[model samples]
Target chain A: EADIYQTPRYLVIGTGKKITLECSQTMGHDKMYWYQQDPGMELHLIHYSYGVNSTEKGDLSSESTVSRIRTEHFPLTLESARPSHTSQYLCASSPPGGANYGYTFGSGTRLTVV
Target chain B: AQTVTQSQPEMSVQEAETVTLSCTYDTSENNYYLFWYKQPPSRQMILVIRQEAYKQQNATENRFSVNFQKAAKSFSLKISDSQLGDTAMYFCAFMPLNNNDMRFGAGTRLTVKP
Candidate 1:
């Protein structure tokens, strides 16, 4: 089983509330990523980190921000959550420098901005 | 920029039948990686199979197999004897050898009917 974990499998918050989605992996992977997805839709990359203290935005533009303070932890924060920010957020990690290897993904956090 | 495309929005297969899902990608890199991931209702992304662009042989796992046409930039997943447990959203992904991020296509929702 994959060692990655995401907390709060589901979240419902009022608009303008600040929310943070937590992601952590125990596999010691150097690369971590965050993706946004909607029901029955494709996943859009929002942010990624090459290692601790490193972060980069993905191809898709996103209002949220992410932090990689530690190698195993990557967290995404939405300063003022809105209805448009309501979507499932997925976290994934892969071994360092193995482009051929697939990622191990978390169970995702389904956020609902009411 | 690399882009993956899954033309089918939804697909269905009867129990013990076979099904194939098509995916195509556009990339300037000659050597890269392709993947098929399955996300069940539980919202966990599971790696189903992967293919290396440099390898001519298609990759297969128990009931899952891929037909990878490097020249055509086409990768398709074939499920043999589909089961109800196979019901999920299937996504095609591409990762260039030089990049750490994987680009995903709009997913295809697969319904395995009993």
Candidate 2:
């Protein structure tokens, strides 16, 4: 099983509410990524972090923001949630190199803006 | 920019049989990584296998294997001895060595019938 963990497996909240999805990993990987995926749809890269204090926006336009204060934690926050932001948020982490292992993914957080 | 494509949106295979999922990607970099991720009904993105762009040999992980054709810009996943546990949505992804963004395909939903 993957070492990455995502909290609040599912969430349903009113529009315009502030929500944060938590992702943590124990593998001590330097790279972490957050992706948004709709049901049976493509995954859009929203945010990613290479190391502590380093965060970058992905190819997809997103209203959410992320922080990487620690090596194991990368959390995503949405200032004002909307129906369009409702989707499954996945977190993944991978080692720098050497091992050449594939990415380890979290269980994912399913958010619903109701 | 890199783009991954999975032409088949849905596929089905009988138990104990074999199934192949096709994936193609576009990238300008010569050195990069390709990956196949599986998302079951639970919504978790699980890494099935990975292949390095520079490697001519394909990658295999137990029952899951990939056909990597660099010249054709094609990477396909073949699952031998399909099982019910294999029923899930599979996504193909690409990551260039110069960056950390792992572009993913729309995914192919596979169902294994008993």
Q: Give the candidate number with the greatest DockQ.
A: 1
The segments of candidate 1 whose C-alpha lies over 4 angstroms from its true place after superposition are none
Output the lDDT of residue B8, model 2: 96
Model 2 agreement with the true structure over A1-114: per-residue lDDT tens digits: 768999999999999999999999998999999988885567887898889999999878998999999999999999999999888899988888722456788999989999
Q: On a 0 to 100 scale, what is the lDDT of residue B36 in model 2? A: 91
User: lDDT (0-100) at residue B47 of candidate 1?
Assistant: 92
lDDT of 1 by residue, A1-114 (tens): 659999889999999999999999999999999999986567888999989899999877999999998999999999999999989899999887764688999999999999
Per-residue alpha-carbon lDDT of model 2 for B1-114, expressed as tens digits? 678889999999999999999999998889988989888889667778989888899999999999999989999999999999999999998888766667889999999999
Residue A47 error, candidate 2, Å: 0.9
Error of 2 at B34 (Å): 1.2
Best by TM-score: 1
Candidate RMSDs in order: 1.2, 1.6
lDDT at residue B36 of model 1 (Cα atoms):
97
Q: Rate the local accuracy (lDDT) of all candidates.
A: 0.91, 0.89
